[model samples]
Target: MGIHLHKLALVGAIALGAFGLAACGSGSSDSEGGATGVENPTPVGGSWEKGNFLPVSTFTDRCVSPRSGTDPITGSAYADVLGTRQDENNWLRSMSNELYLWYDEIEDKDPARFDSSLTYFEELRTFALTPSGREKDRFHFTEPTNEWLSQSESGIYIGYGVQWALISSEPPRKALVAYLDQEDSSLPDAITRGAEVISVDGVDLANGSDVDTLNEGMWPAKSGESHEFKILPLGASDPVTVTLVSAEVESDPVQHVKVETTDSDRKVGYMLFNDHIAKAEGELIDAITELESEGIDDLILDLRYNGGGYLDIAAELAYMIAGDNSVGQSFEHMQFNDQHPEINPVTGAPLDPTPFHTSALGLADDSLKGYPLPTLNLPRLFVLTSGNTCSASEAIINGLRGVDVEVIQIGETTCGKPYGFYPLDNCGTTYFTIQFSGANAKGFGEYSDGFVPNGPFGTEADLPGCEVDDDFDHLLGDVNEARFAAALNYIEGGDCGDVAVKAFAEFGTSNRLLESNVSVPKEISRSNRIMVR
Candidate 1:
């Protein structure tokens, strides 16, 4: 929603004040922050430059673009915010109300115009109070106000607290500008004063030769001549200096395979996926291609470290893996300005500006569908999952599972963020919403309830001696355990009864899989049961 003309005039000043409030105490304050009333100094703004803001014309041109260039995966419900609307005035009104409420909560000290910022507490009231009252409760709007109030409050209270503590002075009407002055980068310089430094040689691990390297280490940063730094520990509990005679720099040494051929010829592949896909995608594709060429039979995609980014690339990769099964299967669909579609009501002209709307994979002819990759036709797959696998990566898992590929999930349950979002750049900031819910085999969306693994995999606690993150490794590798023996037996062309018997011998009769599989009465002990039972 665009800002209302009535509100736009005051937005700039209000924004500056809000920034001031948010910047206090931390931009330069002590790490633990001194007792509230300590005299403090201002922060020194670093030489680092801010990025350029996208021009308003950029949005205008996009709004007029007939190509439908919005992200397809984000779905269509957001189309209302992206396209022109007949009720343009009403949309602006809602946007203005939200902005006013925000400004009032953070910067408006005049209590006459409104109640406490906390007054906008009740979900029923805050969301329900929108001018239209129509979009109320459409989206959950339950962000806690306490934290926002603390973070957004004018630093006046804290600044006064500090001064009073130091000099027993009264609380000043305004925040002591001395402590929060950010025009010059002074505070950071103070915090980092007297940090230690050392010198070391840089040598390549692959070739035992000294090499010139870029040395960009974390603070206590100082202005000094560049030197080859062997190891720079910025915030280690105990900083140790080591002179570098030989340095080791190599690519992340995680590999994937299509099958665990060394162990009973079970087809399996390994993948150690990370969130920063830009640095890993090229190598990831090469690794996958290598596995296919090697005639491996199964796969294990390890995504424990994947945080998420550039979902388009993730989508493209999913198409490579499961595209054939997922094509025509809808991932998510969006609706552009669903409520009122045409000329503006205020001016009786073209909708001044259009906003987009979005939704999940509902039954609609034009619903944007996901194109899945062709199946690998493997009997079973092992997936090394963890909390870090989120966003685009989760989409891949969800898309693949929707195709009925039996995934033996390992490690911890993955981060449950199945809803999709497109960066909705409005004003000077970006707000992302749950624009679309990802659908499964039956076109049922999966956002709130996440994908649970098949069996108990990794524990929350880290194992001793093993790399802490290797819980993901254990999940992927532990499939050779008795827990998976039953699934493996079935895969090896055994009867379901035999597989169940094998699973029972290893995991015991009271095991969950055995209980779930058996329907007949417990007539005989396991030793006397038929092998094929």
Candidate 2:
């Protein structure tokens, strides 16, 4: 998905690690300790407690480092002021007080106390817990506007064209190629899926003490940066030394589109969708058009590594899948804070249902805005997931289910996120504070603990499907792969794969694997919940 990262608007403040339904570790730790108590309501015409007197506009666009030139992506001149860092902090506090979904729960601390706007912004989330005692708000984060804008320049990021699956982050740590960037073909052919990183820049990958060197080489700082790696290709006996030159890489959301014939002679389409970026609209339209032409009986939408992007794109994809069933239904009923129960806090529009988009709303290309989307007219959809399946990706599952389109989840539980935000840029930093919580048509979207597989199904509680571990040995889209095979088997006769593997893939094992998984980059780690206004 492209905040401008696509997921937070495509990628805004949702910076965090990647794993199965595990708790996303964010930098909101400074907000803990509860020393700052909750804010009390103010009289109708008066100010609230704890310095909540001023409006967010008083500090808007006031940055410590103001820009004077035109922005390359937006092609608009910046309107920044030579203001102090405290101005930025005041902006975050006032803005949070106005638009945050949990404004009342937040501890109203002083904006002038913290030196940096980042540390101050982190303290703006609620300290409330879920029914399970988990933190209610886990998606608060921020990134420099310059860094985010650079990626937005062309929806490109500089890297080795590899999405590494951190099977183990610590020693004897194991990192495998989850998948290669389908958008980049310049990467060496030897660096295919399942390839193992034995060493990075001569530093041993597994059990390497210098994580900094390994990380630097694994994720190059800039384009044209050269890094060496001793990689053991998939199924190879020995490792081979290769140089990985970083380049400006863009992610391809729709990849590995294939139509498979089952034993019953039924046609099933498998589309590995990785992001909800704008371009993905065209890519997905093309993919669905092909599948629809073939008259496929079923669709397996793989969203294992998807972190979400444009919500509109997600709605379009849902319409493409469910067709008339969700044509006029509420894709999501979004609600903001109590102060503005009937109006969207961010857009200031009267609160209304986000309809399951019938025609393309053109996120990728303005030319395709009103074009009708091609649909498989599927009654049931199969999803391949992992912890990486998040936000906009989760929205697909929830939205489809809202219209009673059967979703058979075939993998670990998803990253439960029923919240979305419009990435708001203030004074050189884009903040991703939770602005709204969404519910499906049946009034269900409280999945903060994620959707569990094998839980009581048909109740919108937990999704129904086979629970299996991710098989990295075989390439994705391969029917023999654990999750894919399970999906195929389920379609054949509702058969779930090996009991032993299913048992092993449950709670304890999933958590253990997640605990060892790799931490992603701050800028690129998080997917988006893009409010594309």
Candidate 3:
């Protein structure tokens, strides 16, 4: 979606002819780019220097793999020209320097030191640390246009219909099938939620040294790639090995919707929302409408595995949850670099606070627009979260908190990502660079360290909630799931439970707790706080 040319903005096409880049026609990059050599090798950024720079337009559309004719996605003419590693890298350098939120903090390293555009683009970010000493700009990265379009637009990916939960990534590791794509009917019956991954192929996952084989088997590069997995099925005494072939798995973002009548007679609505993709706009609306009909006493949104996609979707979700309390309130406001303080450098529009859109966004189909969204009008809400609850997921908590809507969080700390950018494509490669940081109403956006459960409530980034570990023993949205149960307990008791945080040393890692609760596939796991321009 390179900051998605869905709108197909012509970023000053005259510059292409001025620099004479159009003559370099139809050439493509064969380099499996990294800090590596190239197929069509040329001097890296040949004559470029560290401090000196050019207009961003000078190298725009100059691609290592330039396309011709019409683009199928946007129906716009392809504006690419064959270019070298230098042109591609230079464009990235100039683009980052001109529009990046922390452009001054970036080191203007010589592009000549980088061999491919990918390697050079990778290093062109501010190496600054947040107040918590965490990496400030963890969102800068790129993706192939083909893969990005399919997954971002349709939530499609090539895998075993499994969403892994990595309790420990290092050796003597432990992994579990945290969630499964309900859309995948071909998945083996034993590969249910809470199933532990003992090994992949013939290699011992707990103590094996061969990293490449394990990665390929678990997350195959393409479809029809079959691999053997030794799994310890949930509630089973013995482990069994099963062969799973990777296929195109489309995720059901909003699933497990039901109205639960608690013991105390409160009808609580629950849902397991995983992604914030385009289709979620309609699915969420449908879910909310369904929940409203049941007269739910309270709502618990399970967002533990939601890494985030579209900001508009988050804003819509906020509006649906808060209802009349959100009138005249801003969902989030954008803050750009010092150079473009008053205007969006990319869209060339006035800088403004993005309000909570009451109507459907029509992401999947244009005909779906103009319909008023159904609301719950609940005074308070509950969100089930974890380390994978990031970006737009975190925005929901922050935006709701900004409006004084009580958000009782249950689970570990949420992944902090308040920054967002438009995925921009240049010469076939989609680049995701942080261009803005968003603050909800009351202007509180500095949650780079993440919101914590049971954290000091007085702090802008802290919230009132219980600290509970993710329970893989039960499926998400189940009343017995650790986080969901904690939410239910809080509704009845209004106090945190005595659930002491525990670690799994039995899984083999010397480290007790998981590095991340939701295992992210590298293919689709980029900084997901995507702002569609």
Local accuracy of candidate 3 as per-residue lDDT tens digits, 121-163: 7688888888877778866667766677777776888887787
lDDT of 1 by residue, 304-403 (tens): 5454544444544554454345455543222112222343212233422111111111111123223222234454455544444455556666555556
- TM values, all candidates: 0.39, 0.87, 0.89
- Model 3: worst 10 consecutive residues (lDDT sum): 17-26
Off by over 4 Å in 2: 1-51, 71-76, 150-154, 456-459, 499-526
Q: lDDT: which is higher, 1 or 3?
A: 3
Q: Best lDDT goes to which candidate?
A: 3
What order do you get sorting by lDDT, best first?
3, 2, 1
Candidate 1's TM-score: 0.39
The candidate 2 region of ten consecutive residues with least summed lDDT is 7-16
Deviation in Å, model 3, residue 418 alpha carbon: 0.5
Off by over 4 Å in 1: 1-259, 276-281, 331-375, 426-428, 447-449, 455-533
> Which order, best to worst by TM-score?
3, 2, 1
Clashes of 2: 18
